[model samples]
Target: MSAVPLATPTVPRKRRSEAELKAIVDDFNATLAADPEHEPTADEVAAWAAFHFDGTLAVACSMADAVLPHVVSRFAPGVDVLFLETGYHFSDTIVTRDIVAEDLPITLVNVMPELTVAEQDEKFGPRLYERDPALCCQMRKVEPLARTLPLYEAWVTGVRRDEGPTRADTPLVTWDAKNGLVKINPLAAWSFDELLAYAGEHRVEVNSLLSDGYPSIGCEPCTRRVEPGEDPRAGRWAGFAKTECGLHT
Candidate 1:
């Protein structure tokens, strides 16, 4: 999240009652999880979410790769893809995001934090990520996302099961208690190889850092290149026990 220009404010959309949304999630969970042996493909899940949520859906992309947005936009063209502009991203990440917005059949929503990088530095002192990554992420990533997510009834994420232990049991569909909306992880079953394969097959624009050893790209300051045989997300928040940025948990 480098210092950038102001983001276009997203107009909050009318959301359905929480009860109705929760019931929908319950129904989807039951229907999709009915079969023990068979699981739905990412495309199948995306299609289901597309039809069910329709215009009231959003896809959250870290710009690690454009595969998630590419997969979902096939079913729901012009869907809003929310990119958290924390003003601390790697240059490659930003480049990938811009390319995805131009190439994909979706609307790009630049979700910015309430304060700019300078303002945050002034108030919280410089290099807060080094002092307390959790609080930094809360103000930069989680809060901004939480603020923008309500404009949609449901939100789709690219969280894969193999990312690490924290997301090992991620479900395909569930009620997002934290965000108060339907949460869909279409690629929950996908492996790193599967992800790259899809990106290559579809000719999607991927962040250059992926091939350069930064398996899990995050804010420049908190991220580093991971060694071979390390956890895919080992590069993120390197020195702390912080596994998540307070988004999924």
Candidate 2:
């Protein structure tokens, strides 16, 4: 009897084809669309995502002022929250980062540009943002995000449809073919007013810059206080041809 040992059984691995994955997203979207009266909670959405893509995905919370709380609550503590720490951010933005770290259940992953600020300055001179905005963004924003994205199976963003043309087509769940990962925008349908209302109702701490007319905060060299009639994101990368940090684009 000792001559033959029992063979171990192997569990079959599940491999989802592109169409199957798309079907999952599409079905979820259809569910949400059909149940328009019943707004899905953050927990519900997170649970569904976790169930479908368990052990194969990571949540990338952006920690933006509007959707940070929702993302934090949806994903458990120590989940990766990616921040593009461009080193050119304002002191206030840094303060906000610390505040978020203390208050939320998040593991902050600071994604920095390959080039040091000093190195960049030496190569392109100080205030390179003033000269070539696209190149500056490429070094500061795009490159860092591109480097960090490959480390995860999925990423979560704080984009909302009301943010305007740039984010209007944001889906609740979609494939990022370029990055080869799933991109989830849980709060895609929420408006700025709705976001603020949720924050107020939940007692979420927001960045101080928001109160000072800096609606969309970014690198210190490019951000400014927007006028009353201007768009919320107008303050970021002002006077530059850049609208987004290349994350959405």
Candidate 3:
């Protein structure tokens, strides 16, 4: 079992007002607008955010891999790493989450939706993901994350541009107006190979399913193993028109 944080570590710096936060995003973007190609390295970006947001920064991780958390934690030790506990993950994923929480300098936040799997089934009927994946995702993933994101002034995501067309334009930093926070994607420029290399170099705990061909891991029932030459994200929400779970969209 994951050794979850009893309580989130206190951020010495108070969260800035939304207006102030938005200005910071604007300033950062404007500074980098002149040379997108000359953007700072991932570690440099993480350091900038760590200094600016401090305790108000949250990292969203799916436990598919711990590379993002490992990278971010170097700059902000004991940062809160939010994991949506939808109660539908594979055993391997749960194990990986457990190991990561114990091994890394991070606080594990097991964010849960209002409804448990049983409650969701009792309320909305079983296998709702088959009937309506969007609603299932909204309840199990999106809504829960939306409710939790407001506590922070900024967030870090593991999104990479090489994942697929849907994420081809992922930016390193942007004002996530939808979540009302400054969104940071430090791994935006990394490829799958680069991610694996980092994990190997740092000895980060990775979900076993990743090597089992499930590159883009999501809920167990909704995810599949990708065939060769297929896009990494093709395994997620297979047979459906959904490319995203509505968190980034």
Best by lDDT: 3
- Measured with C-alpha atoms, the lDDT of residue 147 in candidate 2 is 71
lDDT of every predicted structure (CA atoms): 0.88, 0.68, 0.89
- Give TM-scores for every candidate, taking all chains together and pairing residue i with residue i: 0.94, 0.82, 0.95
Ten contiguous residues minimizing lDDT sum, candidate 3: 1-10
Candidate 1 vs candidate 3: which has greater lDDT?
3
RMSD of 3: 1.8
Per-residue lDDT of 103 in model 3:
91
The local distance difference test score of model 2 is: 0.68
Worst 10 residues of 1 by lDDT: 1-10
Clashing pairs in 2: none
The reply for model 2, stretches above 4 Å from the true place, is 1-23, 30-43, 54-63, 69-72
Ranking according to TM-score, highest score first? 3, 1, 2
Q: Rank order by lDDT, top first?
A: 3, 1, 2
lDDT of 2 at 74: 57
- Local accuracy of candidate 3 as per-residue lDDT tens digits, 1-249: 244523243484566788999899888899899787798889988998999888888999999999989999999998999999988999899888989888998889898889989999999999999999999999999998998888888999999999999899999899999989999999999999999999999899889998999989999999999999999999989899987999888
